[model samples]
Target chain A: MNKVMLLVDDDDSLSKFIKICVEESGALMEVKQVTSVDKAMDYLQNKGEFADKSRNPDPYVMLLDLGLPKTSGIDFLKRLKNKKEYAGMPVVILTAMESTENIRNAYCNYANSCLIKPFGFEKTKELMKSVTTYWGRYNRLPDRAD
Target chain B: MDKDNPLVLLVEDNDGHAQLVALGMRDSGIDHELIRVSDGTQALEFLHKKGKYESSQQPRPGLILLDLRLPKMDGLEVLKEVKSDELLKDIPVVVLTTSEAEKDIAKAYEFHANSYLVKPMHFDELSSMLQETGFYWLACNKRAY
Candidate 1:
């Protein structure tokens, strides 16, 4: 079976760019993009449009942006980590913010890993490749069943 | 030898695979010490300083390359124990194994393994994967502890 990825971000263009890049690389079987933390939660919870598990299987990895609309990424990270059911889900922080405070906060909130999002196309490609290769091929993800 | 560089503990039963990993780390451009253990029991002994390793002066490994299949105490058990421990939980445990089974992957992550890597089929790919891993974990990643 093909691996799945869930990308949570507010930027449509950025999400689109990543979708295109990741799809082109063929690293993930499917890349599900959601614009807000609420939508992401809904999808994960199998509500609304994402109620269909066959179409939207639980992602093996999640790329979460720190900056979001209603619920901030850090807040989302904390919530995800606190939940008993989602404890095993690996959440990698992918964002433009590179400050020490942000890094410390993300890790403190129990984010699995934190990476700075690259700006340039080539750099973005490299980052995406690394992200997929590291998470999909290398990192062992927790089973959604548990 | 860079004395100040963070140490890595590699646990693998296959001699050939362990040597390849050694070679990869040696040429990885990131200079650091890599300690090798042949089985899961030795890994625990080295970590807990039990038996012959009671007086061993080796420092706590900043990174651990653990194999799932072993002679005694499978990798999952080791991971569960390590992650549950107060002192050892902070250290990153990267599962390096040949199995790509979903169950294994799920179990490892559930046990809170820091990362997981499957051995590459080709020599060059293995070396490259090791290079990327070394650079990412050792050079870039910020350790919690």
Candidate 2:
């Protein structure tokens, strides 16, 4: 099975970079991108344009950016985790904010893991490779019943 | 301990598994100190600094590798307590177990486990998994503290 990763970030360039890196990392995984928290919710719930479950499979893991235009990523994380249906989904915080407070907030809101967005292209690639290799190959997600 | 090389608290009842973890960490070459507790009660005591762990100079762990089937108390119970505690909630807790049952996986995640990894039957695979786990959690994942 091709493991799908849901990437929720507003930065188009960064998201694209991550998608390329993940694909190049040779981990049999797919990156599905969404620009905002609302879009992410829609994608997860298979609402609106993502109504086809076959085309839009549930992601094994979600990489959420804390900064968003409308609904903040932290708020979305809290909402997603609070729901029993989405509670088991792993949500990894991929953000540029390294503040202890922000990291604490992410964890307090039940983020599965938190990673700081590394600087430089080489560093980012290395980080993404590790992220993909670990989350894609090693981590186990709960079975999603259709 | 510094963030680069933080203490790792390992809660596993099986001595063989604990030794394998030690070997795996050594093989991974990640600089970390592994503190092993045979039961869930001891694990909590170490984390909470109660009983024999009080006044000890060991630094707080940056990561916890928990086994679900633990003696004295269940690993899920320990995870719930740790994650619910304000002081300990931020520390990453990865569920390392042999069981691949869907219910256990769901319950561990529901309790806010940082990650869930099943132990492979093959020795080499287990070691490799441990190596990957150590590198990812200790070196890759950013610490809150």
Please give the CA lDDT of all the candidate structures.
0.79, 0.88
Candidate 1: stretches off by over 4 Å: A1-3, A20-31, A52-54, A81-88, A96-110, A140-146, B1-6, B25-31, B39-62, B70-73, B99-103, B120-132, B135-142
- Taking the tens digit of each residue's C-alpha lDDT, what string does model 1 give over A1-146? 57778999988898888887887776755678898999999989989998988878778789899999988999999899777678667788888887767876776566777777767666666667767777777665554562
Q: lDDT score of model 1?
A: 0.79
Worst 10 residues of 1 chain A by lDDT: A137-146
Report the C-alpha lDDT of model 2 over A17-83, residue by residue, as the tens digit. 8888887777788899999988988999899999998878899889999999889999999999899
Model 2, residue A38: displacement in angstroms? 0.8
* Candidate 2: chain B TM-score against the reference chain B: 0.96
lDDT of 2 at A125: 74
Report the number of the highest-DockQ candidate: 2
Q: What is the C-alpha RMSD of each candidate to the true structure, in Å?
A: 4.6, 1.7
Error of 2 at B83 (Å): 1.2
lDDT per residue, candidate 1, B1-145, as tens digits? 1124788999998999999998887776776789999888898898899987999998898789999998888899988888777667666788989998988887777677767788889999899888878766665555544
TM-score of each: 0.73, 0.96
